[model samples]
Target: MRKYALLISLLIIISAINLNAQDDNEKQLLKQFHSITSEEMSGWLEKLCSPEFNGRLSGTPEFVASAEWVASKLKEWNIKPAGDNNSYFQWFKWPYTIINETGSLTLNLRLSDGSVIRKNYQYPNDFYPGMNSGSGEITAEVVFVGFGVTAPELNYDDYKGIDVKGKIVLMNRDVPHTDPRNPEYKKWVAYCYHQYKLENAVRHGAAGMLYVDGASANPNITYDPSIIVCGIGPQPLEDIFAGIKTTNKALIEKIRASFKPASFNTGKVMTIKANTTRVNEGRACNVIGYIEGTDPVLKNEVILIGGHLDAVGNAGRVVNGALDNGSGVVDIMGAAKALAQSEIKTKRSIAFIFIGGEEVGLIGSKVYTANPSFPVGKSVVFINLDMVGNGTGFYVSAGSSYKEYLKYFEQANAKYIHRPMRTAAPEAGEYYGRPRSDEVVFRTAGFRTMAMWTTEATKKVYYHLPGDDTDAVTIDIMEDVAKMIYLALTEMANDPEIKF
Candidate 1:
């Protein structure tokens, strides 16, 4: 009996020693993460969000300069350039559109009584030109296609038998009305993006598409340049449906009550002419740097860390975008600095990228996914940091999809920072078929993407406004976030069992 007891005691001692060793290793990692201080993050944020950067609009000199600054910082940390031509920039051109002052929209409805009612809609108030609208003119009969959805899977087709060829089609903003509390409501919202609607219109050979604002529609909407697509406000839409027997309110209620196609001819001929200028402002770049892994086999795979480096330029004042994405850029820089300076060597390669043209519509990330520096199929995971310095705690967008990734964060939170984790549904920010940031691009590219940010509701008052300056970013919160990111990256880099 004494011999058995001695053996049991030995086993317990061995286990305790192993646990202690693991705890010591975790402590060392935490110390390395702390090497990226709040002061360094603050300094980086100040420089990136300053007025001299001119809000870092993509395709502009200011934006390129910001990318250069990020490349310089990466070089300082001894991170090797992972971009094209042995440089830190993966350059690509993007098409941009600007609404010139000459842009106008005129609606004329011919009455059956041999008289015509003409109305000229003012710019911005009544209607605004779509960012991707092509310059053209069309005068044809208008067709009312409900919701403009062509979902054959759902047995719901708005253009089932209606011939919309060479005629303007007016449609509502969202899918046929469903209860907001229903689980399918979010899915419907996702499907109701302008792209789907425009595609539907194009498939039906419509000459032009006009979107009427529904109850839940976004006031500001933009779409790709396929055909001439335009948005008409409620007042102008009401004017268009004035003499028709069915009112806009009645039509909306009818469609909402029953999820069915409400297609009809307006019996009124209308004219729509859209003229805008397209500027191909050369090319912008995604700045990339790498820290190669030690393990021979696993080094072939990559873990991507990225943040957008562009903002909404100027809105009569400098949109410093300190909290929008300036904070996110600094957070990535902090992670890069921490990992580069530490002695810990990852098992898989880690790539740091600052994506440009995110503000305009995730253009940079889309371009990268299309033409990647490395094979996207070999990418193990993607971690996106956007607006991370706003609130007190951290929240992972799409947390449910990456429960394994969240385990490291949970462990790190328990040991180092006890900040509470806020839960956000994966479909929260996805609406109108558009992702809220660059993370969506990676997610669509088949990468397991995770986006970390602060409590957005608490900091949304200054989110995209001119007031989103340095004052909106909390330094301590940013530091804590940086540490959490570092902990997660270290854990991911060391663990070989984690798969794509």
Candidate 2:
């Protein structure tokens, strides 16, 4: 009886000690969380949007400079390097293109009096120079090709019965199948890529392309030496379809109603010009850093948080991607600082990666997945952030399967942040979706991925345009996102009972 009483007393004392230690740890964590402020996030966003980074185009010297700055911050916080050769950089080949000037797009209108009227489209308003367009110009008649897709197995060929040889092709950005929720959408997924569309136009002998994606800078296209490309807004599109009986929307709906060819000559001659210089020898990297865990066994398990740091470069103008990805990078930086400075010790390791070349392609993520700093099998979850600074609330995806892991973030938001938060489960089994984001790349590489986003936009979003500047960001939400990451990731790392 005496021995049992002694054991019970000992158990009570241990529980009291653990409770007090947890209280102290929570106090320290709160201090670190409070350190994340909107003022600091605003300053970081300003610096990222500044001209010194040259829009942070991957494979450019300015991008390397920006990467060096991020690495310096990690070093200042005493985080260990988890990159190549004990450095904070995982190098990869990422050649880039430089649009030298604001290229011109002109519409040639035919008059009945044997005369012609040339309507010139202005830059950034009616047209945008393609980021990866081949140098020089091409003057040719425009042939409207629906969606620029040619899938014979699906009985859909946008190029059939149309002779686009040595002519310009006018096409939209995606495939005819627009719904992603349907199982049939997977059949058209191969044709949804910009690279595929441009290459298909080239394959059909098109000399130039007028993509109907508005006045936005897009770099995710294949550059062919023989073709010129430009993004035409609604005005030019309207001009191209002026005499046609159907509108662009009506024609697209017609084609989608029944998978058929809607190819036709618009009798519109347009001039597409661009002077872009290609640099094939450029290199880029992913900045990776690590914080070792205290427990020897759990230290091998790594929790990764990453965001793309590259954006659309100067396509005639600086596309300050302040909200697109600068928000995400800065948010991760704030979280990293808090985690590194906190007094609460974590049981599992944590990694921070500033990915590059996401604008051009998911090149940095591909490189990291192929040659991971830590084993992918041992990773807890890859949390991705992109365009997370413009909204009033929080959202997380791929959480339903990882409910045990997602609870920490939910707790953080409920206890401290006090924002409207939501979560989504990933599609079951393999992801046969479009290869558009770094999250998709990681998911394809067999890693469980979770992504953070802001909801209910407070400002107008200028996607891939010159107006994607600092004004588009909501700094208060950004600060909250950073704090939530810091608190949630630390707590998750310390929990020993978490399962994959």
Candidate 3:
């Protein structure tokens, strides 16, 4: 019995010693993470968001300069270049179409008095051509289609019994308000995407589409290249329906209230002519650097830390994008610096990637995944930082499938950050969905991925606006986020048993 008690006491002593060692290791890591200061992060952000960068538009000289600068910083941190040809740049072509000033929209109406009236709408105010709009001219009868949604599963079809063949169809920009208690709510939400609406319009054999922005419609809709899609403001739409029996206001009210089809043919022959110049901007790069791990076996595994370095190009005025992604770039830089300088050696290699062309699409990250410098299958996890410059706390989204990886973040937040952490699955809607950021590309490639942001709502106020400059970023909030991510990366890189 005495021998048994001694054995039990020994086990307890060993457990206490192990716990003490862990506590010490955590304290050491926290101290190293705190070494990444606000000033350090802000200095990098100032340069990244500076006027010299010219908004860091992808496939432009300004964007290339930003990439080179990031590579230089990684070199300064003693991080090895992890790009093609022994350099820090993974170069790839990023082709896209840009609408030039030559684009114009004109509406012609044939009056009952045998007279024709023509009115030209100004760009960006009365109407704006879609991003994917093709250069075309169409003169056809105008048909009104409400909401432009068609769902056979819910027994709701907006295009039902409507012959829109070879005619210009006018549609409201939004889906109707759905009651959560209704059985069709889920179906309504799923089919409410702009692509579905455009597909419905094309499927109905419409020659062109003009989206009227109603109070209930989504103002910012994705463009469909299948036909010429243009956005008509409320005033322009009202003018288009001036001679028609039904008023725009009346039709909008009916559609909003009932969520039913409101289709009609105005005896107005509409003519739409649009001329757009498509410019193909060539290639952009992803800046990559790595810190080798201590353990040989685990070093084969990789942890990806990245943020997009591109912003919406200059639109008459500079869009600094300080908070949109400048903050994100600095966040990753801060993490890289913290990890590289610390004595703490992770078991797995860490790669810092500053991706380009993220504003246009997930092009940079997708290109990397398609032709990666490091084996993508060997990637253990990806941490994407974007718009982490506002709000009080952090939002960690990894989807439910990555709950095991998310626990590291939860534990880190509890121990080091002590900030509110919102754990969200990808299906939690736009907030945590695959459409959010570069993490989407990695996640789609079957790699475990996580995204961290300071706040979604607060950061969006300056998201892509011209006012998204250095002054818009909340430095203190960004500092906290940087620390949180640094700690999380350290913990994840050190853990050996974590499986994707």
What ranking emerges by TM-score with the best candidate at the front?
2, 3, 1
How many pairs of residues collide in each model? 1, 0, 1
Candidate number with the higher TM-score (1 or 3): 3
Tens digit of per-residue lDDT, candidate 2, span 355-392: 99888878999999999999998998999999999988
Q: Write the per-residue lDDT of candidate 1 for residues 186-286, one digit (tens) a residue.
A: 65665576667777788789988777742111212344454676667676677778778887668878877887788899866666676756567636789
Model 3 misplacement above 4 A: 1-31, 98-129, 132-276, 425-436, 456-460
* TM-score, cand. 3: 0.73
lDDT of 3 by residue, 433-468 (tens): 225467877777776787888764454455555678
TM-score of each candidate?
A: 0.69, 0.94, 0.73
> Which ranges in model 2 have alpha carbons more than 4 Å from their true place?
1-20, 428-432
Best by TM-score: 2
Scored by Cα lDDT, where does model 2 land? 0.89
